[model samples]
Target: MTDPRWGEAFSTAFAQLTALWPDKVAIGAAVSGLCALMETDVALAYICFGALTADMTARVAVCCKRNRPLCRGLKRALPRYVCYLVFIVMAWAAQVAFQRGLHVGLPIVDIMLAYLILTDMASIIGHLHYLGVPVPPVLKWLVFGGREQLKRKAREAAGRERR
Candidate 1:
């Protein structure tokens, strides 16, 4: 049988080890939060890109239906999409390295994720426009500098050249 003194000593050691329980709990929560954020960012990125790809593919099919087969457009677009996916993955890896390896803060990761989301949204908008959605001119201008805006600028430049 264990001695009563030994039991008392074990309880004392256990109590001492658990004295900083709050700090340990805080650290665990923080790590768990960071992991969840990383996972969510990745999932969001994938969803955004997937939607963008589908929209773009549909736009290509519609645009090329008269001139070329849909399969040809898909063949051409597949490599470009693959390249974009690779770029996104590399960027994500760099962000992770900055956070984990270099001990960078969360704001940088947040900024990168925001940038990814905005760009994906913009591309999706552009594709929607190509698919004949009547997206607002102001929104197009805000997101893409507007095709009409570029045409107007070109016309202004031509008028100045005429002078």
Candidate 2:
């Protein structure tokens, strides 16, 4: 299983990143993955997922069309290309770190799980924000806590039943 703390950290990081740059960074990262995915079979499915994210960006672009302030602000901040470059480099670094047993401090899978959680949280929050929905901070935190609590409760209940 993945470390729960990673997801929490990821969510926090994602929230901050999205708050700063909105969807441009995310769309760029997704596009970068698509470029790489086209070159590898094992990664092709992930590339398709990236393409779906690009679609989301297109939607956001449409939604923000009339909001010139938000549009120009997001456009001027960062290039999607840089974000995509960072995404690939990070993935490569993580793989290298794993191969070198850098994950001795924690399982590599757990680290990956953390990034996944962070990414998912970022995506959902960005999407909600894009649609002008009010995403509650308490509710966002619960996304991390609820699953762990449910799992723990289930385990305890199972143990009791066995006894």
Candidate 3:
């Protein structure tokens, strides 16, 4: 029989995921094995999760403020390309976790789960923002708190572009 703890962990993770995005049950399933590791190791998993979450938020806020077809310029786009590289590496790791969780194992799965969970949450939040949904004020201050610097940079870039 499968461990009851596994079921418990999956259920809790699934509930949390659905709370973030109503259709995230599949994503929850994808990361469920990693969730099991989270149940086993709380502090480390959460710290990694928080780090990835912050990283992703900054990327999203920056990208949202950028021009479309993101990689247009050589010099001006270097920072955005760096963020893209970070995203690509994280995505590759998530694929490894989903495809080879059995072979690669715990710490890999744990870290990937944190990254996947937070990325999934960020996607949902970005979609809601695009749809004109209002963010909860507390969440705004927490997740988007660093946006002022990004805004300043964007304005500086705009002034340069107009010159």
Q: Can you write out model 1's per-residue Cα lDDT over 1-163, one digit (the tens) per residue?
A: 8557988899999998799899988876765565465554545555545755775666575658447677776776567567655655565576677568757543333344445455555766766766677888777666555434444654674476446
Worst 10 residues of 3 by lDDT: 68-77
Give candidate 2's TM-score: 0.34
- lDDT of model 1, residue 34: 52
Taking every candidate in turn, the Cα RMSD to the unseen true structure, in Å, is 18.2, 18.1, 16.6
Error of 1 at 99 (Å): 2.4
Off by over 4 Å in 1: 1-43, 106-132, 145-163
Candidate with better TM-score, 1 vs 3: 1
lDDT of model 3 at position 151: 46
Ranking by lDDT: 1, 2, 3
TM-score for each candidate, following the candidate numbering: 0.47, 0.34, 0.27
The clash count for each model shown is 0, 0, 0
Pick the winner on TM-score between candidates 1 and 2.
1
Predict model 3's lDDT versus the native. 0.51
